[model samples]
Target: MKPHQQGTERVITSLDWLAVLPVGLLLRQVDLTGCGPTCITVSRWRPGAGAGGLEGTGLCVCKEDGAVCGSDGRSYRSVCALHLRSWVSLQSGGERIRKAHDGECKLAPVIVVSPKKIHNVTGAQVYLSCEVKAVPTPVITWRKVSESPKGVKLLEELPGDRVNMAVQVRGGPSKHEGTGWVLINPLMKEDEGVYQCHATNMAGEAHADGSITVTEQNKSKKASLLAWDNPS
Candidate 1:
């Protein structure tokens, strides 16, 4: 076998980046050597949104300056893997979502849970399940949106803590796991917020949002008062 000759390679430039960044982010380009031919991908970063990876968006075939490009070819620029995600998310919307192709990636469904709204002057018991999902199965989290109303009792992850609640399971991961289930021994006003189920994987990340409401436990309140004795 004979040795092959060397050729010149350029740096991927800032202009190349601008072509690839999400609709909003300013495009930056840098010159660099490019792989021969590849299925290009788009990604994005929304202000308050979770991660939307590059694989789930558009794919463009990129080639070396003089390399043979693939058929069904469209124009594209070079982008890094991280920034690529931001580009993908923005591109993924109503119209683009319907388009399916081997070259393009599909985003998983996004869930926004708005938990039932209720009010309670007295303590209460409640069973609430956060919104759920399959792929990159979601994990549950707790938060307090409003101030704690008096006489309210909450089964928080821990006293004085609002995050890091362990995921309670009916069956193991083999049978079933990672489904969002939360218990409120005595629900209270403090236990109200957007309980979010965040799902993630190599594909991308999304969240399921649900609100929490605490209804009054009148019976428990009465029993507590009856049990209390006046110091005076």
Candidate 2:
């Protein structure tokens, strides 16, 4: 009976006059009822008789304007449609909803599990892993950070020319998340350096660093034998 005002947009709550109007007809200030002239637009009518129906007691169907993200973490067809849903929710004793943003929701990459420093002896196997969460499914990459002879920093993508090193990336243990791993078999002194794991998406990017410490096999065995013979 009364028009609900939201910002500069007005939503007419009366639906008795809309019953006789043809579907998809746009009317402006045409007095259909004896009450007075009122501006109303009925975008379309869906056959039925209820909340989403087209019968005399049905709800008003707003036209498709644009997409909007709601505070409830849901997306609506448009602002008007969001307003209608908010009104209905309130009438049903639910919390009122508002627009959170103009576009869909997105999340940047967040590293939940980061790689840790590892200590191993040569000829042993080692694994470095990192887990990231992000929207739009981020791309995961593994890099080896090293210093050149000139003391310049160099970043080489994993498994590049390394015969003993391999990299694997796979989709999540959870939604919108992924895990990446770097495996080095028969670990050598050359593999002892810093490794980086990077996750990138349209929203943003994230990176973490981990180091590997490798000891000579003979030296490690000798130290173990010495410790075994001279336990304190």
Candidate 3:
């Protein structure tokens, strides 16, 4: 097809040739034939229409378009790319594809903000928090890391009738994100250990760890006194 310059856009006059160019190259061609400024349109050729007739033509090119998500949970470089794929699929007798949303598709959980190490004295309250981002929203759970008698590591889900500890989770300090927190009131020596933030979704799972260190009230004061005396 021969494309002639029409102001800032390109217009294809001949429909005798079909080209399936790479997405990068097509995008770089600023003068790609298009129907409008925002989107690329594609049309199927009519069998009986002469090359001079623009009958049954529908598709255009959008060089500046952003990526789009497909209904099949995949990402396309642009709307034109998705339409091209859909056309190819239809020609192959496969399912027709449609646009799901703007932007790339996400399918896995990611730990955005991990909990940090904490040190506290006995009888003090402490909070550990974690944030995760994922598509379809992820479920956040808190777990305490423990060692078994056989030296294997174990993860115990938190807030199971533990009077001193509580866990809470909620969605979004941002889109597609969830935050979780574990509160330990009147912290004790037994509550000192590694805590895990576990996030799971239909696509996948993610994990992060935080720790708590507790000191008896008397021991904490004594240590402070020792540090003061040493001046180090």
Q: Pick the candidate with the highest TM-score.
A: 3
The count of backbone overlaps in candidate 1 is 31
Report how far residue 108 has shifted in candidate 1, in Å. 3.4
lDDT of 2 by residue, 69-184 (tens): 78887656565555646756788899998889885457789999999999999999999999999877889999999999999999998899889989999999997789999999
Is candidate 1 or 3 superior in lDDT?
A: 3
Please list all clashing residue pairs in model 3, or write none if there are none. 41-59, 41-60, 42-58, 42-59, 42-60, 43-58, 43-59
TM-scores, one per candidate: 0.32, 0.60, 0.60
Backbone clashes, each candidate: 31, 0, 7
> Which scores greater on TM-score, model 1 or model 2?
2
Q: Give the TM-score of candidate 2.
A: 0.60
lDDT comparing candidate 2 with the true structure: 0.74
- Least accurate stretch of 10 residues (summed lDDT) in model 2? 30-39
The regions of model 2 sitting more than 4 angstroms off are 1-68, 71-104
Candidate 2 — which pairs collide?
Answer: none
Candidate 1 error regions (>4 Å): 1-109, 112-114, 118-121, 145-178, 215-232
> lDDT of each prediction vs. the true structure?
0.39, 0.74, 0.77
State model 1's lDDT.
Answer: 0.39
The lDDT of model 3 is 0.77
Shift in Å, residue 74, candidate 1: 22
How many Å off is the CA of 107 in candidate 2?
Answer: 1.2
